[model samples]
Target: ERRFSVDLVGEVVRNFTLTLWNTYAFLVSYANLDGWQPAAGGSPAAPAALTDLDRWILSELHTLVGSVTAAFEGYDVTGATRPIERFVYDLSNWYVRRSRRRFWKSGAGPDKQAAYATLHECLLTLSKLLAPSMPFVADAIYRNLAGAQQPESVHLADWPAAEAARIDPALNHDMQIVQRLVSLGHSARQRSKLKVRQPLPEAAFWAGADAAGVIARHGALIADELNVKQVRLLNSDLEAVAYELHALPRELGQKYGSRLPAVRDALAALDAATAARTLLAGQPLALQVDGMALELLPTEVEVRLQARSGFAVAAEGGLVAALVTDLTPELVREGLAREVVRRVQELRKSSGFQISDRIRVRFQASAQIAQAIAEHHDYIAGETLAVALQAGAVSADAWLIDAESLAVQIELAG
Candidate 1:
């Protein structure tokens, strides 16, 4: 086994680097832009003021603290380090990535304040937890997030204690189900060669009774992540897929010889649902084919559920998720608009504009792309923080999105 290989070391470094840059540094920069400062007490907002996402991450944080504390107390350094690494990944990838809109929304309110407070609390606690293992990096993060709120050095700060009152096991379980469903949904999309940016009509998940509440609470997040208009809870897997009887040509050919074709036809004609149930119940299928009675063993026929038309599906551990892949004309146009927003945002970054900088955009695009821009003008402009969008001549740095040439130029709004 290559468990301790250099590749593992590289992966560890990459994970830490991504967490630090995307989560820690990015949040710090945004805080500065918003003129936000951490509270001296370093307390999170009241539960009622926080969103489900905020509560979920905070719950995860306390859980991590408890596990790390127990591991360190028992001298299990590896156990302690493993949880810390995983927490950082979740903090960056899920929490921060998902809360970006909350942070970016204009003006100040309880929601925005709660988002900042929750994130600050998480970072402050993490700095303290990492102090023993990573003294220098921990100190840097502590100084950046805590400022004058806490001890100057992370090493001087008290070890973080788990807040048991904040930990909700039920919420954690629901979030786990939601994450797994999202993962399965993404896999289905990939299998269908569908891009994440392409807007779809609906996605459905069936993970038994336990997931009912989970879907009700977190379905919006799923729809947003999967780029679907709606998230539907499937009552049964049958709604998303159809089980059909497939006769094994080789096995049936040996048994029935010249009657094999007729046998296949008979199996195909049988009510697939009834035949599947009968076969699964360990009974052979009784069929009348060409005036000959046929008894097909379970091994002679394969039962498989075909994904419903217009859906790409994936299943695991009795859970099934399906993504509707059919694209309507409106959906296609909306997807194009999303692509335009992505390109413009990329150009803004590459052009070195500040995050708060309002921009004016001009573009020359194919007819289809132009039509998308015209139809979704407000959405494209609002998303990109663009003051105006005008049709004009474009420069050489053109982008190709969905096989359509789009050339855009952006400047700071006057």
Candidate 2:
């Protein structure tokens, strides 16, 4: 009955593989798996010390287990598949994306061990859940993650029962709100045409009292994802965004004919905020003009948000996330430093350097970029796993970022 898009199907498959399978592969690649016996995707592993982030993902995993289990029991294949897809997104984009540092940090400490254990458990459970729909991939992931700990194949493994004690509903609710705010922040960044790599000064949010607590708890994660220096709360949504009304000229012209201009004028005269609210609430906008009353559906008009000065804002479902678009000198320097690290990392990859390869870095750059390197020397060194950074002749590859050319070389640490 409805139009189908091959692209949509492709996107879903790609997201599922990249988030679940590829992420698992990445973890296994980096993980020091010697003597580590992964859990058999049973009840959740309760690490002695768990960060809020760790606990949050565990909660999500168990919740997914309960939902998928119920759906499969009812023979609702679609329901089972959909929840797995969503969990893959959360695990890949939110959990793994945020926890990459823990896995990559120099030492195998308790925190690192916990992370490995938690992720391993998740992938194992996910493979079992996916077995019915995607058998081959599920068996492959389960075999790798579980090793000799469980049945050789995922189909032979027992169903992962939901761990009631591990599923924290409150934590899940808070994380959901945090994810919404971060998603809005990303929209704002897209509108501003600024990439995530370019750090911004601050992001402000306006939401209900309920979400205030969530924002307070996960503000650091939000800031990290949005590439903002700080997260602030605004008392009102109007402070973050103003609505602008637009008439769909062609549609309105076809509907109103001779009265199209009058309709456009009426729309322009209406209070944008009130009109937007009415339309978003699924009510027709009522206008009185020229002694006539007219009601226009949401389809006849467009609503645009005008961000407050120095901010790029996105608002939806009563939540607003605004990013301060003005780049301060210090912020610009930090962004450049990140760009340099990214380029260096790319060079390392292209040069066939292993993830654990420590390197000596040498760079020749324009004055401004060189200054950025000087200011954030330790940061760049730490991020790129550079044993030494020196000013010298170019050797490897040259990259031009922000109109500044940087020639950099990285060699294995002696």
Candidate 3:
């Protein structure tokens, strides 16, 4: 009777680990054969981890154990695997990439401190979740985070206390929408044959599903990341066109059997939101055929809306489509402003400028560029390590310039 909801997670993890290690081990073994020296002897990292990045990884590893323990208590293996996937795929990939500069920062500064703190938290969490699955990697990360004052092995210590307050439903929802928008943006970039680094004029999103204030609150973030000057909310006519649905073949046919056609027709009669809520909430859709009622579960259903005509960005359920809008004068200025700061920073870094190093930039360009920088002088100063920016390009030998980039050369003129 106790086996009613048995925990197979430990075995599941073991099986998954074996599959993964088999793939990894083959590569490493073959590498050793090809390299003339054993691949296992390779030192891809330092002999001992001492950097902030190392500490960050350790902290995330430890924190992850607490999460896994909580997930196990709830008997939710799927929830448990989520953070594990994050550690491997997202925390490892995105966090590591974002913080590389801090890890490789030649000099210690505020930037370095921030990078360490962020990475440490991620590492500690990841290590804790991993402890039960791969004790060695878990212990290694845990011990490193512990350092002189903390316990040697996290396993020998007490189970971590839960921090339930840290979970915010609103933030999670916002992040999910943001992630979908980002995916759509990446798709748009690919379709345009443009790299993310290339500046985009504007992006428009059709958000018929967005709650009243959520889109407004996070609109700035969407605009910034997409390099668009503005985000336009499409009209209701566009929303209807974008939200048209199509039936999923296998999903409906298998679950409903003969009841599928009636259910599909009933769903088509309902609007996107009403149909989604009714089907998702475990409420019976009440499709009657031969006077017999049927029930539909969430997973047994799949509904996706089609792309609307002239829509720059739209999402029906999880599927997304985006459209490009005309870039505003304001957007072009912001893009230019970003470019100016980037070039300035490159100049500062290469010139061995201190974080507080104040410099002057005098660029002669169309009145458009001049007015743009002038309007956002404080931002320009903060971002570019500039004491003052004067709009006039003069011949100077010391300045490093790139005119082809529509950017005049810059330097520390004595």
TM-score of each: 0.84, 0.89, 0.49
lDDT of 2 by residue, 1-414 (tens): 535688876886787776676888777887753344554534344567678889999999999999999998999999998988888888888888899888877766778778888888788888989999989989888877776656888899889889898999999999999888899999998988997888998999887788898888888988888888899898676877899988898888898898988888888887888788677546788987687998898888887888888889887766778888999888888889999999999999999998888999989998888999999999999889999989989865677898998998889999
Q: Candidate 1: where is the Cα deviation over 4 Å? A: 2-5, 243-305
Q: Pick the winner on TM-score between candidates 1 and 2.
A: 2
Best by lDDT: 1
lDDT of 1 by residue, 1-414 (tens): 886988987887787855755678877888998998876677678778899889999999999999999999999999988888888888888888888888888898889989999998888888888888888888888987876656778888888999899999998999888888899999888888898889999999876678777888888998998889999887777787777788998998888889888888888898886787677556888999988787999889987758888889876555678888888988998999999999899989999999999999999999989999999999998889999999999875778887888899999999
lDDT of 1: 0.86
- Report the error of model 1 at residue 168, Å: 0.6
Model 3 lDDT tens row, 87-194 = 564454334554544544345454554444444444454566666767886787667554454566868745555454434445555555665776677776665555
Question: Candidate 2: where is the Cα deviation over 4 Å?
Answer: 1-13, 33-36, 39-48, 147-149, 250-266, 278-296
Q: What is the lDDT of residue 100 in candidate 1?
A: 89
TM-score of 1: 0.84
lDDT of each: 0.86, 0.84, 0.55
Ranking by TM-score: 2, 1, 3
Order of models, best lDDT first: 1, 2, 3
